[model samples]
Target: MVFEYAPAPESRSAVDIAPSYGLFVDGEFTEAAGGRTFTTVSPSTEEVLSEVALGGAEDVDRAVRAAGRAFEKWSALPGRERAKYLFRIARILQERSRELAVLETLDNGKPIRETRDVDLPQVAAHFFYYAGWADKLEHAGFGPDPRPLGVAGQVIPWNFPLLMLAWKVAPALAAGNTVVLKPAETTPLSALFFADVCRRAGLPRGVVNIVTGAGETGAELVAHPGVAKVAFTGSTGVGRSIARSVAGTDKKLTLELGGKGANIVFDDAPVDQAVEGIVNGIFFNQGHVCCAGSRLLVQESVHDEVLDALRRRMELLRVGDPLDKNTDIGAVNSAEQLERIRSLADAGEAEGAQRWAPACELPERGYWFAPTLFTGVTQAHRIAREEVFGPVLSVLTFRTPDEAVAKANNTPYGLSAGVWTEKGSRILWMADRLRAGVVWANTFNKFDPTSPFGGYKESGFGREGGRHGLEAYLDV
Candidate 1:
């Protein structure tokens, strides 16, 4: 049965774009300490989205200090009281859900259907779930009287802006810690709007501060001595830098980084369901997903049949304005990202692989790339080895389960992997051998507030969901 939700008033009329540059610090929004700002562009049309504050190292210090001061009192609050603030913030998010969705689509260029239905609802669910756990830490297996880190430094990625904010901030607050969160430089709007939501919820001043800037600002936040915890979700290279910066510090750290996951198919699997899972694993969110299943490993017997079905499905994908509910694939996050995807695709072709894309016309204004596939990709090809992070897939075949496992674990990343098989024994067998944090049997990219999601090895560490999330913010 199809589910219908209430419609919201559209935001088509051009409101005067605010001077997008400002820091949310100490219960107020203020200009950057160095009085500098930078232009933010809409990835869809390459138009100037707005000017955002370019915060400096000093600005980060100020944000951290504010969080630290707030933490002293916040940590002393009863867990039930802390949970009340989180519940209030969740309610406000639900009230302003449409506005936030539209802002996310405009800034991040994701499909409206996804931002509205998938991202926003999950964002609220995350807060609500974590809020309920606030006063129940004793039963959460964290031992008696778990303690909160004083102040948390959280940096999120561009893919799911508001949702990532909710994921990082919700649990931190629920666990009795204050946070100075930083959104990606390109997608700071939702984080700023989230600050407004916190204010409307009457959350305590300095309990959650948002400072906007690029890599330098993030480096400063991680390196600052006052921050008691650091949580980041982005590329693996940046995760390494953060790990190094926090090496000797007493702060707790959690990193959610890059992924090049495998979606394996056995001959007895249900083909139609597997096809849907494959589409969702990579193409959903325009393949900007960190846990995107870029590698398709099909058992040698049904390889041809599965590829044919996937090709037909790929042709039906709709690519257009992100605001359209019908859009299936939206623009690449930015021109830089489009170029990166294009370059890697070129490498695939140059390295003797067959490349194919659906015959679809993209809007001339936005940064768009059609859903793409490269078959005949060997392990040596750059496309097979690297994280494309776009609407691209590399197809390969394997003869045995051992070969499948070996090929799947070839990459340095161990974030996620999927298996499609009718045999229960094989499912358990593969799950045990797969060197990934999240393993899906007959499914891919499934998320739950109760499931712990993170990576292993170079993909990054520390779980983000489930009762385990409190570990990152607590003194265990």
Candidate 2:
């Protein structure tokens, strides 16, 4: 007889969702100039969470102007004073982390475990890490007197919304730049909530402004002449567009774009640990991560062994409501995102690759896709080449170390890559060979505020996190 586990759902009462949210400019929430709005839903239940103002070009202009007006006063403040505000924000984040986590799970459809443990902790940690840096900028090796880049425009993606906001905002603020930020339309609630945190912290008016809308709002903000710097975390296609928009302009731009990261497994790897890494690398965040290890490059000698272990592990993953603590995989962020995943998975099958998914019943009400894998995948296959941005993995085999390195680096993206082996020398060699910005040896999906994270080539440029992250917002 099978033993069934009791349901353990996190209470949504932790957060008080506002019926309607507005553009946060000049430190206050106000309706959009266009008088348009969009409804944000909880992907887990298809429940409408709230209506958010849809920002337009005029709203973006107002935000940029607000940021510009605040830049001088904010930048002139002593680093010690700036540090104090950051510390307050960090403390507030910790105090209300539970509320934010539940709200994030509701808006983004990531598992509660991740929103609580991974996303919230990182968001707070990022603020704390950068807080310390604010007072010590002169001591930082970027010469004795690096300067702030006036007003910065930032755009963050839907995946890990709060964390991405922390990543972009923390370092930018620490560097003494005022900001006009645009959170992805689908996941704007957390950012709106964060604006409240700024108010509670007594941060000065217009130091940070959040404009909620789709791509057009983001474009307007980035292209605004008042913005001295632009930082974006999104798709490569959009990154390229931002690049073009900022070309020949005075704005300093940085992009953290898409990736088809590789997780290379060798025969010498510890099977159990490697299997865990493989799962975490791809399946984490429902595989919505930009640096997610979407491609698996396994040694041909141990292919069958690794596949069997992976299949067994995949079977154990529970897929359900984001609020359920036991859920390993949650609902996709939206109907559009679910459709994208479906189309890509279909392409994987059409290209003659063998597709597999564990026997798991999905909830009929909301957007869902099972954890999937495509074997017998070649480089030419669309699934292997494109960013699926879902809980999907493409398996490819390599005969030798040289072959593994070649296959891993063949893609246009070089955001991140992982190597799993017990041998120290081989790990070092593989790390040295991979063109990715971040390399993981015998580990996957591990992140820290001190570590620099970004990509190379078509994955787009610029790093976030650590001391390196400060450079993008500062004027040397």
Best candidate according to TM-score: 2
In candidate 1, stretches whose alpha carbon ends up further than 4 angstroms from where it belongs are: 1-17
User: RMSD in Å for candidate 2, one decimal?
Assistant: 0.8
Task: For each of the candidates, give the backbone clash count.
Answer: 1, 0
Candidate 2 local lDDT, 1-476, one digit each (tens): 98786799999899999999999999999999989999999888998999999999999989888988898999999998999999999999999999999999999999999999999999999999999999888777788999999989999999989999999999999999998989998999999999999999999999999999988889888888888999999999999999999999888989999999999999999999999999999999999999999999999999999999999999999999889899999989999999999999999999899999999999989999999989999999999999999999999999999999999999999999999999999999999999999999999999999999989999998889999999998888
Q: How accurate is candidate 1 locally (lDDT)?
A: 0.90
Q: Which segments of model 2 are wrong by more than 4 Å?
A: none
> Model 1: per-residue lDDT, tens digit, 345-429?
9999999999999899899998999999999999999999999999999999999999999999999999999999999999999
RMSD of 1: 3.0
lDDT of 1 at 151: 90
Question: Deviation in angstroms for 179 in model 2?
Answer: 0.7
